[model samples]
Target: MEKLLVIGLDSVPPDLLFGKLLDSLPNTKRLYRDGTHGTLETCHPPITVPAWMVMMTGKNPGALGIYGFRHRRGSSYTDGYIVDSRHVSEPTVWEILGERGLKSCVIGLPPSYPPKAINGCLVTCMITPGPEKEFTFPQSLKNEVRRVVGEYAFDVTFRVEERDSLKRELFEMTKKRFKLASHLAREKDWNLFILHEIGFDRLHHAFWKFFDPDHPKYVVGNKYERIAEEYYGLFDELLGDLLEAAGADVPVLLLSDHGSKAMKGAFCINQWLEREGFLKLARPPLGVTEFEKAEVDWTRTMAWGWGGYYARIFLNIKGRERGGIVPPEDVPALKSELKRRILQLRDVSGRPMKNSVFEPDELYGVARGDKPDLMVYFDDLNWRSAGTVGHESLYLSENDTGPDDSVHSMNGIFLYHDPNNHQNQIKSMNAEEVAPTILNLFGLPIPDGMKGRAVKLS
Candidate 1:
């Protein structure tokens, strides 16, 4: 049986990996040239939390019962909770393999904070509050991780004003993560190993405008114009070293949860709702205020939205929300009206923005948990949805919460390198296919409930 190594690079777009940065990434480039690589279609609301979980569990967001990182708690207006490992009830690939007596080493898979016990070692993901808490499975592994990398970094604060300092922390965090990964690969006894790095996503979110000339905010000949290349080169070098540590013949799978691209701007969804009479406020905000902080008259409001890479709109329907107003039978008509108006919205320059709206049932047949009544992608994801209110205009040139240079896209990336069989081919695959593909590589049967089929690599 062949050992499997899965490297998850969060928010890596195919164009950059296979185009601009290809030559600079010798390790990734070689894999792409010799392996089967292509675009991996991400799940709806393509945020990291659910996408990575979706890939690992072979379950849709609905099945997983997680919509985004933060979910509204039982339709409470202000109450919400961040998703963590406790929320994931589905059996992951590692858990499934463990049942069959195969050991695995897993690291940094999101919503994995308060790390759960596995067949092998496990280091929780970005959601971890800090290293002081028990972030490793079996508890003893925490000491080993500290001995290897001093203090483990769960994530970085990317939405800061200081670019130089942010850049330094980003690279340092990645180096430490890879160093830990390399050390564990050599020391741990495991048939399967998985490592996820969030640095690439942070790089894109913070420095995209500096590197990509086509970005709306980009200026030619900027100081950080070459930052993307430098980061990609460093990533490739670390990847090469980690592969060496893993073994020469291990089958490697490289993928990302979702892709990243230049963010045009943020559309204040709640402000728009207020303007359209869907959301009502007792009084106008004095200045910019988060939706939760604003004085909302929920009794009069029809719908409200939460912001992220995409917009999640919830209707204040009768007998549903605490302050329900819209009648249950009137939901379809209201949703239709809202969708029509949203699609007709224009950009700042008065051009028709290409927006898409989806109901939970439309995207996932069996919608579950605290799902939004409407899922919206402003300008097909070019424009991020801003949940904050009190902005003068419906459009803003930056993210409402903080500084963000990029937004999530539907297509990420996938690369499979098999040393034994080099049947190089490029083909698109869905996020659900990854779990089954891993099972197939180890000659294990994919569970009947999995939504995807195994990809034939040989």
Candidate 2:
């Protein structure tokens, strides 16, 4: 096939691709009618950059060495660059496709920072607190875009609180870029084309109340219905437009990095760690002390990120641990005690999380190389897990800071236009599966380091 178009619609739930929402755009519904639809499992922490990189690289965080967006850097500002092609442990599909001498087009791909010299068109998406201005695509194309597509608001940074504003900006931006991307898709004669709205993720974070039955903001009255109704309508319309603009022969693939869940509160996993004696609290002496370790207000502390993907808690160890503090002999007892503590996590109300943890050993390959030390699931909706190796805080305030927004885990949407061989059943593949799947799709050889199997779609 000469053409493949994938629209990675950020937080778009699978429901948006079918059911009542289908009525808005008959064309898209038809795509779903014949296409394979399913859910996608994202990586642990379900973060934007890490998930995208893992999908492209086909390696887990352990191999890639990427975990989250912002790490407390070691005092170097420029060194705090967001993850990108430079940081990715493996070659991207673009690089691989490029090697095959097939031209490709990529738009607004996250973690594509410090953009490499791709064989075809390349652009960065989800830049920190800013716009696409930080991108490193070819200057010829990058400069030509301003003149051809009209002025883009590159200063716009994605924020959870400014849900409405962000969507409006993204909606407009996506439309413009889609036009350019479509043009490139045709003019460049590329074998594969990737376009992303990324707005769907933000929309869900901000307006989940409109769609989620569990959300308090959900209003059945005619008034607030417009919020969810209009956005979905627009979503369908944009996708339809892209499908129509591209030559119909091109297969289209729609995906979300991860889904979201509505959050009720934060559960301090670290607090439970302290209670279990897994974490040794550094209490200050009662008398004068020049260096008092910052008081850890454990009750109000939390380690959170947009975590519908997953979280893990392992027995901190000495040698194998990222930074070993605990001795080797203590590891056995610590692992058992940590496992017990993880099962007993309670919300502010003291309810048990049971076995919300992913149990990587069972789920994936839980072997040393493939899994995190302690694998678990957080309150997927809004509650995320945070903190580094040894930090006192774990829980953060769950109070909705009014109209604020964030991409959460609930249900990521899916559709496979030409699911050649593998039935695109409503199955779920982790973020790690993407790298392998993409490589397999084009008949390219899989790289040596990845753990996931290529989706044999032939």
CA lDDT scores, all candidates in order: 0.92, 0.59
Model 2 over residues 1-458: C-alpha lDDT tens digits?
Answer: 56678888776656555654667766667767677667777765566756777677776655565655643233221123345456665677778889889887888787665556777877766562343454636856766667657764432444355455665776687667667666666667577788766666656656666556666445665233455556666767666677766776667777777765565544455444555554544563343211113343333222211222345444434454344456778655655665665666665555655445544455444332323455566543455443322323345444322343344563566677773443435555667777677767677778777778875433
Error of 1 at 432 (Å): 1.0
Q: Which runs in model 1 stand beyond 4 Å of their true positions?
A: none
How many residue pairs clash in all the candidates, one count each? 0, 28
Candidate 1 lDDT, tens digit per residue, 82-183?
999999999999999999999999999998888898999999999888988999987999999999999778889999889998898889899999999999
Measured by lDDT, the strongest candidate is 1
Worst 10 residues of 1 by lDDT: 418-427
Question: For candidate 1, what is the TM-score?
Answer: 0.99
